[model samples]
Target: MYGLIGKIQVVPGQRDALIAILLDGAREMPGCLSYVVAQDSTDPDAIWVTEVWDRQESHAASLTLPSVQQAMARGKPLIAGFSERCETVPVGGHGLATVP
Candidate 1:
């Protein structure tokens, strides 16, 4: 399985809006196993996004999806910067289906 974890810093008061866009875009991801958007406990303007997909290609393809593209465009203005990003290989977890 493929996964991504990232931290995005948004304009001081725009986290909620950005999160809403992300969640809305995530709803129809074809191969998505999980997509979580969380607030950072220590940073008022920071959001953490974690996503899991059936394959790396699925994750890559999602970037080209119309809903995702629209969300990115909508969220672009609210974004201050990307602090960090990490790519991961997922095994199995409670909410994720087992994979070889």
Candidate 2:
């Protein structure tokens, strides 16, 4: 699986519009299993998106599409800052019980 966790700083009053675009696209993304978008409880302008793709290829393919690119373009103006220091997560590491 492929996943990402980061914060997208959106312009005032434009968060809703940006999220709508991302969520809509995620649903249609070729390998997307689930794409979750959330707002920071402390900051309304801070947005977070967690995406899970069936495989690495699907996520990569989505990046080449026009609609997805356009969605990003729409938020370019609203973005005040971006936490882009994300990395590829290890596959199938979920639900491993850790000893407390």
Candidate 3:
């Protein structure tokens, strides 16, 4: 399994709009095991996105998807910057199908 955890900084008061775009794009992703978006507890302009995929290739391929491309286009202007991004080899998790 493959995973990614990242923090994104968005323009002030635009976090909700960006989150909506992200969630919409995530809906139909092939091979996506889990995708979560959360607001940062201490930062109004920061959001956290965590994703799990069946394989690394699936993650890479998702980037070329139309839905993802649209989301990127819609969300790009709202983004201020990226703070942290980490890649991981997922083993198992409570809600992840990989937990078998």
RMSD (CA, Å), each prediction: 2.4, 6.0, 2.2
Q: Which candidate is the best by lDDT?
A: 3
Give lDDT for model 2.
Answer: 0.73
lDDT scores for all predictions? Answer: 0.90, 0.73, 0.91
What digit string (tens of lDDT, one per residue) describes model 2 on residues 1-100?
Answer: 6667778888878888888887766546776665678987888888988766777787888888887898777767778888653645646646422211
Q: Estimate each model's TM-score.
A: 0.93, 0.77, 0.94
Best by TM-score: 3
* Model 3 stretches astray by more than 4 angstroms: 97-100
Whole-model alpha-carbon lDDT for candidate 1: 0.90
TM-score result, candidate 3: 0.94
Better of 1 and 3 by TM-score: 3
How close to the true structure is residue 31 of candidate 1, measured as C-alpha lDDT? 81
The order of the candidates by TM-score, greatest first, is 3, 1, 2
- Model 1 quality (TM-score): 0.93
Clashing pairs in 1: none
Q: Please tell me which model should have the higher lDDT, number 1 or number 2.
A: 1
Check candidate 3 and list the clashing pairs. Answer: none
Q: Write the per-residue lDDT of candidate 1 for residues 1-100, one digit (tens) a residue.
A: 8999999999999999999999998767878888899999999999999988999998888899999999999999999999999999988787863332
